[model samples]
Target: MRGTEPPVTPDGRYIVVRGRLWRKANPALDAEARQTLVADLMKARRAVRDAVRIRDDMSLRQARRSVNDAKVALGERGPVWWTDGAPDLNRRLARNTIYAEWYAALPEQP
Candidate 1:
């Protein structure tokens, strides 16, 4: 996600990663809010890793839930943040969704 520039849709709704679409955080969110959510998401992800390493089912579940909550709050999951009613293409292959034409035009893709 760092070495090469990830291609984000023109609408700014999703970023293509490994040929799959992942929802972007809500652009409407203020910088501080977005930063805080991102921080929480990272912490939760670390917790998930630790739980898995320790073989703690309860902690794993809690960590996963926290991660989900942070993602939703960041507008990366749950309800669509946009008002246009476009169906979510998250986790879908870029070649199979409405972004196919755009993705095909890219100079490089996964």
Candidate 2:
């Protein structure tokens, strides 16, 4: 997560961060569409932080929903975007899954 770009899986389905697998945004999305979604996502994330700071339960819920919606639209959550029948592995530690060998071989990040 500290790097400009995390190490992505060989198949491009996920990016490895802090030894965990996170689903990537859909590659099929056009640049404009992806940019727009990412903007909305960042806005929602800021709202989440603000809500937590102020202890506003209602705003927190709404902001979280916005975050979830953006993530879904970005193909990072809810359902698998790939058609290859692979199981969703979002949030799994890379060392515990099929990517263990590959993950082990990556150069250590500072």
Candidate 3:
């Protein structure tokens, strides 16, 4: 993601929005920061109970911050991540469905 351009669809319809393609002004730092923030958001979501019980304003704010961090990082790359890797990564991710299944089956550690 740091050095590679993103792919575009053959029909130029869709692009891979996530993974290593996303970048920012400072791509390396921003990408890692975004990953950290997303991971934190996931942690917060998992820590909560039912929907009604998850209403912690502070944590919600933190999730917003994480979203902003990721958004800012993506902006820094100036669309390079989206436009460049669409074809190759999209096919790769689609074909690698089994990897996703395996990943989803992994146990989460608290």
> Which 10-residue span in candidate 1 carries the lowest summed lDDT?
1-10
> In candidate 2, residue 48 scores what lDDT?
100
Encode model 3's per-residue lDDT on 55-102: one tens digit a residue: 876666665555555544444322434444643232244224433543
Candidate 2 lDDT over 15-109, as tens digits, reads: 98889999999999999999999999999999999999999999999999999999999999988889999999999999999999999999995
TM-score of candidate 3 against the unseen true structure: 0.28
Show where candidate 3 strays beyond 4 Å: 1-53, 76-110
TM-score of every prediction relative to native:
0.96, 0.95, 0.28
Question: Against the unseen true structure, what C-alpha lDDT does each candidate score?
Answer: 0.94, 0.95, 0.43
C-alpha lDDT (0 to 100) for residue 12 of candidate 3: 37
The lDDT-based order of candidates, best leading, equals 2, 1, 3
Question: What tens digits encode model 1's per-residue C-alpha lDDT throughout 1-110?
Answer: 66887999989999988889999999999999999999999999999999999999999999999999999999999999999989998999999999999999998764
